[model samples]
Target: MIHLKNVHKRFQKPEGGWFDAVRDTSLHVRAGEIFGLIGFSGAGKSTLLRLINLLERPDSGSVTVDGQPLTALSASALRRARQNIGMVFQQFNLMANRTVAANIAFPLEIAGWQQADIDARVAECLDIVGLADRAQHYPAQLSGGQKQRVGIARALAPRPHVILADEPTSALDPKTTQSILDCLQDINARFGVTVVIVTHEMHVIRSICHRAALLDAGEVVEILSVQDKQVSAQSALAKSLLEVA
Candidate 1:
């Protein structure tokens, strides 16, 4: 449901040079599967995720999501298309001042939903994230896991076709990570939203990903299926990660 072909992206370094964030990277994410981009810091995993939603446009290649060429869309069309592509971030990115319900309602409000519809969607999303009783809670009052759950609820409130999660469990403890992973897995099975997760942790990939691309230095080295081996991702870095663990 998503494709990136020969994509390249770079940024100006603060030291007066160009740094390539993504280098001729190509990847495909099948529908209704959790695809993980596994790599270390500076490996461009996050940049790759942004390309799928056109948050970071490629310098040279094509980005297609759900059969639409994201790079070819006009600004207005892209805005409309983005509603079908929800994103969950590592930092939670919640407005400290807004309650969980209000935070989840922000996207629906932006999409011009009626107040009644927004209220229904927000409550439904809170229930999905198992935070129905926390609707009135603010970010400052919640735990790290709770904050991330709120982020997930906000992403789901739009009922997007695809969900791009960037290191969704990086901030939490091991137990909390498992809970979030389970939530993601449940969401995938129940909603059939194509999930693409970016993370440096091999445990994250092995835990929930059906298919994964091993990335290094902004290039994908190998693609592995969890159902086939049920272990490591089978790349050199992946082996190293297993060894370290």
Candidate 2:
């Protein structure tokens, strides 16, 4: 339900010339599937994720999600469109002052949801992420894993059609990472939300992704498939990435 065609994104380097973050990349993600963008540091995986929601508008080409051409939308239109797309950041970007319920309620409130409806949705999301008992707790009071669960709950509060997770498990330990991935998988299975995750860890892809695009230096070098918990690597780069897994 997401497509990028000949997309290019660049940023002005403070030193001088421009640096290409995404270079003529094209890919499609099917609805209700978990897709992965795997790459090393500076590989543009994060930039590509932001491009899907136009958080970082592409310098050229098109971005379409759920059949809507996001690149052609006006400011207000884009803002409305973004409500259907949720984002989970690597660093758990929660408000320090807001309680867990309030943090999840923030987006629904901004969407003009009635207080009663927002309250119900926040409770549902908290339950989904296994954080129902922590609703009154502030971000500072939670452990790293609990904070990430709160982030996930907040992202799900809006009933989004797609979730863009940029390194959602990178901050947690191995056991915690497994739980987070399982949570994402459960969300995908139970709710049918399309997930496009950016992660450098091959195990993350193998554990959850059905298909993945391997990127290098701002370009897509390969598209690998995972079946029966096995990743099929076609290119040398893909093989190398798997070797490091």
Candidate 3:
């Protein structure tokens, strides 16, 4: 379970005092569901995601994950906790200098897994993402879809309880995007990992999310649930955005 109550975030404006990025945001994402944070540019979707992992601390509020206060943890403790929280970026953050298996094994190595264990885990992850044949290949040699698959593989390597993806498909074409979304769905269904995705595209939410939180001007304006082929929206902003997307 993930919960944030009255969460707020601010940033210093370029030529002035301050601007709110996220304001009094509160939402809970249930375990084993794919939840989406959807909004247009500058809607604070990414910032809200950062707050969940403490990559960006909230100005004030409680950030509780599995009943643990992430905001109150010591640096070392937070680091340890993060091992079970995987992150997949918009750009596949793979190392150009490393092979696919090596890139996937990076986290296990940091956690001090033995070489044998790392190899086995990396192989399994590769197989899961359908990149077993590309284990020895470099990032530059892969297609965009292939790269994102590798990113998914790397994120799942730790067997994390939750996966946070930030605009992961924004860089891909339609067909590629669908494949990536399918991969995410597969992981959630097969592993029971709670997945929270940040996306501006409404089709993304419509396609895979069990529930979605709509944000506008730093605040959550609506929450939409997708079930039985019906999508209901309570906020005008959400309805408008849905129409546009």
Candidate 4:
């Protein structure tokens, strides 16, 4: 449901030179599939994710989501379309001043839902993320994982069709990361939402992604499916398993 056609992103360096953060990257994310983007730092993974969300517009080429040209839309129209896409970050990015319930209700409020509707949605979302008991708690009162749960609830508040996750599990410990990964998998399977996860952790990709692309220095070097036999992803996974044991 997402397409990037020959997209290129560049930045003006302090010395008056341009650095290409993303170069000629093109990929598609199908409906109901969890797509993973893997790379070392400086591989443009974050830049690529931001392109999909229009947080950074492409300097060249286009980004289209579910047949609408994102590059062609007005700011207001883009804002409306963005409601159909949700994003979670490594930092959780929760408002420390807001309670969990208020945080989850923020998107609904922006969407202009009725007060009763917002209340019901907030309750439902709090339950979905297993934070119903902490509805009145602020970010400072929650653990890292709990804060992230609130972030997830807020992202899902609009019932978006697509979810973009950027290193979502990086901030948590392994045990907490596993828990969060399981929760994300549940969200994907239960709702049929198309998920795009950008991470450096192969274990995270293996646990949740149906397919993945390996990016190297702004180039997508390989796209592999977990279900496909004799693929590099499978081999790499096998190697990792062998090493772990």
Candidate 5:
């Protein structure tokens, strides 16, 4: 469903230096696979995800989704194409001004759905996330997991073709993290949406992803299958996390 070729992203530092956030990262995520991009804080995991969505354009190389060349699209065209991609942030970027239902309805509203259609989608999404009863609650009143669930609901409301999750469960406790992961797994199993998870949490990747890539120093060092069900004696990703010591 997604492909990247020789993708490079460099940022100009205030100190008159260039920082290579991503360096020639190329990988393919097949349709219906939960692909994990594991990396440390500066390993360019998030940069790679943003590159896929064109939020941060690549300095050189290409990002293609379902055969559409995202790098070559015009701004307006990219905007339209982006509608098919849904993203959830680490902070659960909900509109503080909107209620749970309103926040879930936001994406549908952006897509120009009718009020009735938006309401229907919101109801369906709330039910899927088991948050139908809390539809009136606000972010301030919800737990971290609940807020993230609302984020997932909002992302799904648009019926996106692909879901890009960045550190989705970082703030939640272990039990809550499992809950969110279960929800994600269910979404992928039921909807067949391609999931790209960029996270530092190995547990999250192992629990849900079908395949994974380990990133270190702005490069993809290794790719593995979660289905392998065997511990890596010398996992590059685990070593980056100091888990293999």
Candidate 6:
């Protein structure tokens, strides 16, 4: 469960003036549902995702996740709250030197988990991402898909209540992307983790999202529902995106 109300974020331009990255946007994501934020580059989908976790603190607005008002939280409180929210990046942001298991265990370690518990959680996450056999492998040794799986495993190692994936499949080939999507779908179905993904690919939304928000120039254009792999497009931008799919 996530909600953003009257959210606005602005960045100072290099020369002068400010640029609005998110403009008075409001959205709600229900528990255990896969939601999508789709838009072209500069649409601020990624910024919105980061805002949900306060990675980019909004200039004005409120962000609530799992009933916690993230915007009002103290730094320590926010740190504790973030443990329940996981993020998967477009580029697999793995530790180049750490083995798969170590990478997955990093967050747990930071959370002060006992060594035994961290070990168990890492193993379980590795299995969930189908990377059990590669637990000892380094990021450089894996294929693109394997690397992303490692990223996913790391995200799941925290037993997070929500997962924010920013273009998780964009870096992989189509077949590999499908595999990653399947893994995410399985995670949502089996674990009931609320997932919010940011992607430009329509097929990514249609394949896994229950609902999606189309964004343009840092604002929400429309929210569309997906049923049986069909996206109900109500706006011109939504229809155009669907047509391209």
Instruction: Estimate candidate 3's RMSD in Å.
Output: 1.0
True lDDT of residue 178, candidate 4:
92
The residue-by-residue lDDT of candidate 1 on 45-122, one tens digit each, is 999999999889899999999998989999999999999898999999999999999999998999999999999889
RMSD of 5: 1.8
Writing each residue's lDDT as its tens digit, candidate 4 over 1-245 gives 99999999998999999989899999999998989887778889989999998999999989999778999999999999998899999999988889989999988888889999999999998988899999999899999999889888898889999999989999999999998888888889988888999988777767788988778778787786775322244345334532442
Mind giving the per-residue lDDT tens digits that candidate 3 earns over 31-144? 899999999899999999999999999999989887678999999988878888889999988899999999999989988899999999999999999999999999999998
lDDT of 2: 0.94
Model 1 misses residue 193 by how many Å? 0.5
Instruction: Give every collision pair in model 3.
Output: none
Candidate 5 segments exceeding 4 Å error: 228-245
Which window of ten consecutive residues has the lowest lDDT sum in model 4? Answer: 228-237
lDDT of 6 by residue, 1-245 (tens): 99999999999999999999999999999999999999999999999999999999999999999999999999999999999999999998999989999999999999999999999999899999998999999999999999999999888888999999999999999999999999999999999999999999999999999999999999999998999998998899888888888
Model 4, position 163: C-alpha lDDT score = 91
Scanning candidate 1 in windows of ten residues, the lowest lDDT window is 227-236
Best of the candidates, lDDT: 6
| Model 6 segments more than 4 A misplaced | none
RMSD of each: 1.3, 0.7, 1.0, 2.7, 1.8, 0.7
What lDDT tens digits, residue by residue, belong to model 2 across residues 1-245?
99999899999999999999999999999999999999999999999999999999999999999989999999999988898998899999999999999999998998999999999999999999999999999999999889989888888889999999999999999999999999999999999999999999999999999999999999999988999999998889888888988
**lDDT (10s digit) by residue, model 5, range 1-245:** 99999999999999999999999989999998889998779999999999999999999999998778999999888887888888988999999989999999987887889999999989999999999999998899999999999999998888888999999988889899999999998999999989999888777777899988888888988886766644352664566564632
**Candidate 3 least-lDDT 10 residues:** 227-236
Assess candidate 3 and give its lDDT: 0.92
